[model samples]
Target: MKRFMLTWVLFILCAGTANLSLAQSTVYTPATDLTLVGKVLPTQQVYHRVDTADHPDMPPAVKRLLTNSAGLAVAFKTNSTTISAKWCTSPRTTLSNMTAIAYEGLDLYIKKDGRWQFAGVGRPNGDCTEYTLVRNMAEGEKECLLYLPLYDETTSLEIGVAAGATLQPLNDPFQKRILMYGSSILQGASASRPGMAYPARMSRAAGLNFLNLGLSGSAKMEKAVADMITTIPADAFVLDCVPNSSPDEIRERTAYLVNTIRQHHPKAPIIVIPSTVRENGAFDQEVGKRVQAQNEQIKQEVAKLQRSGVKDLYLLSYPRQLGEDHEGTVDGSHPNDLGFDRMLQQLQPQLLKILRKCDLAGR
Candidate 1:
């Protein structure tokens, strides 16, 4: 009788193991059909260079946003409170003391015009939170749903929240996706907060979904990287890492990367964004002019490819209006909050044009 009981116990254990494996294999259901969902900025303490600034710094949040292999979630924190924040009509960021996490993903809610609805959500694998909603851009109340378990020690925490647009979940009748490749800036440098980053902002503005593959200080345009980019089913891809590459390197890699992506997404539009806010120009030499020139060359080559039957292609020049001289970045290389805004201001129009073209092309 004891032997029979042991055999039954083993069978039950095996069945449980099989069930767990099946559960793990389940793919995360994106709130939207598009892959390029907008990102939300997590809250943290402000880490300012100085104490006597116009802004009054706060302590870090009780619960912190985790940093993965990527060096994100590190740029905005003060001691505790996230320094990157948008000013409300009043002057208060929200407190983020509680935490939750769904094993698969998390959902966001917005109380706009006095109705609560699903705003947007993040993918479980990529470590991105703060989703962009599909609704119109107006004023509203936004809240995040934490999926992961919160630290028991964490208490009420403060977070910087942007008050411009509401985020809603995307539901797709058909599955389509977009991918973006770029540098640290794309990874989100000095954007007041994570959600405030231009890519995240642009994703919201454009109403398209995307996968952000931005690498901080690591956009080498290597063939291996290009090879990896070809493996995805992206409807569109943006190459904006040239600022970090040298002239010759940009010239050499542009065609290869374009061709590589083209091999997979033949009809998808590939937009090339030049470097923004660099070279420390005195408004004379246009120090960033070199990078700008490289972008132009890439644009021309893309044109040439189109003539050779490459389906959809586009170019976004660095607008002279948003030069580094105007805001003068804090590090002379990376843009501070002001510089980021200026860069975004320049990129926004160009981005709109390209996205509109994409929509027209039926992507």
Candidate 2:
């Protein structure tokens, strides 16, 4: 009788193990298998901003940052009731003002009713993490846009689906690639998630291809970097480097960057944006004065470009873009999600108007 009971218990334990294995089983599709948007150069299989090997002239800072997947996204469709992902991230330290999910996690969006809505997010557990993004819903075909990590390298990414669910590439839904180049704010620092970055937010809001070329502290408009950006054709360009550059650097490199770009893209619209008001500037007198100086210098530079027969060029700045309350930034340097949203609200419509005038956007 005792032997019989022991055999029964063993059988139950084996059954439970088998069930657990089946539950954990999922078929994953590599991100490369899906349509990729928000990329300026698709010259490599790896998800990098630019192929550093090709552009040996690129600044060391740019090359170091090229591997960080800032604005890359996978556009795909799946009929799975449960969606999951497995991604390997590069080694990086934790950001004090940024969430691990925002710096190195995946944000998923689903198209419903002709609009993109937040579906879910995959939180990182380690260097290689797998998390369920969305689950237990009505099973139907859904289009998905998965934004990659903003501040870390996505070494490899694959979208997981329950076995037998069909996954297919989604055609690019956005139009007119718009290149946004600037600092850490543009790189998505301090946002809650990858999709909250201003460029990513603007991309969804305007339904336009906004590629992020944010070089953190390196967007000094170096001639090498300028040459690299001009090599790629864009319908419009957003220069937001004032906050990262010194007054002298801006005076020296701003025109050279614009003129070189004009030589390549004579007709593409160039939109220059001044620095946002730093919250600390209110307390620190030098900070306030420097921001004011930068603001004046950018206006002067844009005016000079416009006067030099630089057609289709404009400087875009709004009163209190970060809100007058000074509650927008995460660290007084980088924008939090609210800071980004305020910046987007002011920049998008004005930008769309200019793009429409240039006939790059739908009127």
Candidate 3:
């Protein structure tokens, strides 16, 4: 009986050891050996959309589906321990479901050499697509990998988390925050990689934390959605929805979208953007003209509110000039890379003006 009991004990120990080994092999490799004693925590995260419905200025089915919270993330450590983790997702394609219309299989990238490089791809649920587990050092400052994609097409990608760092909060308390609400271009389509999108670029350039709420085709200023926007604390809010909606819808919802954010961020500045370049060549130029008209309407509304004593409302004027694809867009309606640049260039100064206000407001 004693021998049998001993044999059972040995078996149990061996089995446990084997199981642990297997588990260790399957998770993300730790980037550091720093003491990580605290619980793994979730930092700032946004839940917004990118839309392109009002842009009759847009041609057919082209759309970008970027999200505001799609920026950088870092992991923190509490003890000197090695952790193994892996990420999973459901569908690799963008055509998953309704929510996917906003966020699909986009991964975050790391910025290196003044350009963003692909880090790890985003996974949905337990369907982890095996990315090599990289190690990181968290010195409690919460530095994790930036989840943005490379904007410059020629940059090389990097993997592995850094050491002694914690994840950057989606909402930086110190830096000014900019909230971008727009269509798929803001949503990050065909940018060659994640984080390469225009909104992401703007975030990096302006040195501000970004909240991208770019739904692919869902920028209709629904009261419910607008109500959701009110919950976030933003230094400023941007509304760009010409690729998804019609003129009437644009006129109707633009005020509501701006006003909703304004209601919550009463003192926060609001900048409304006219639609970017569209397809259909010169024929589609009319869409740009209509967008200009819509801008006029929005401006008038702001003026009315200003008369009521409201303050700090502005507009971004996008030219009807041809996008990179003078024939108008790579995927029929959406702007190509060159188009994104044009849009970004036009937006930079306007964004700077608003950010300046953010600094003064101390958000």
TM-scores for every candidate against the unseen true structure: 0.53, 0.93, 0.61
Off by over 4 Å in 3: 1-85, 95-127, 132-144, 148-174, 284-296, 299-308, 319-328, 360-363
Residues 252-292, model 2: lDDT tens digits: 88999999988999888999989988788889999989988
* Candidate order (lDDT): 2, 3, 1
Clashing pairs in 2: none
Q: Considering TM-score, where higher is better, how would the candidates rank from best to worst?
A: 2, 3, 1
lDDT of 1 by residue, 1-363 (tens): 999999999999997896555334322222222221222222231211112222222112201121111111111101111111111111122223111221222333333454333444433222332232223434333333221111111111122233322233323212235566777666555443444445545544454544455655666576656765676666778887776667777777777888889887777788877776553654546665775675666666667777877676777766563553566364555665577677777876776677667672233
The number of clashing residue pairs in model 1 is 38
TM-score of 3: 0.61
- The lDDT per prediction is 0.47, 0.87, 0.50
Candidate topping TM-score: 2
lDDT by residue for model 3 (1-363), tens: 999999999999997996566454433333223211111112221121223333333323323332233433332322212222333223343432113312333344344465444544443332332233333423332222334221111111222332442322223322455676666666565444445566666655655556666666676666656665666666677777656667677667766777677778987887777666545534777765765665666566656766776678776766545444474355645665566676677777767867676573223
> What's the lDDT for candidate 3?
0.50
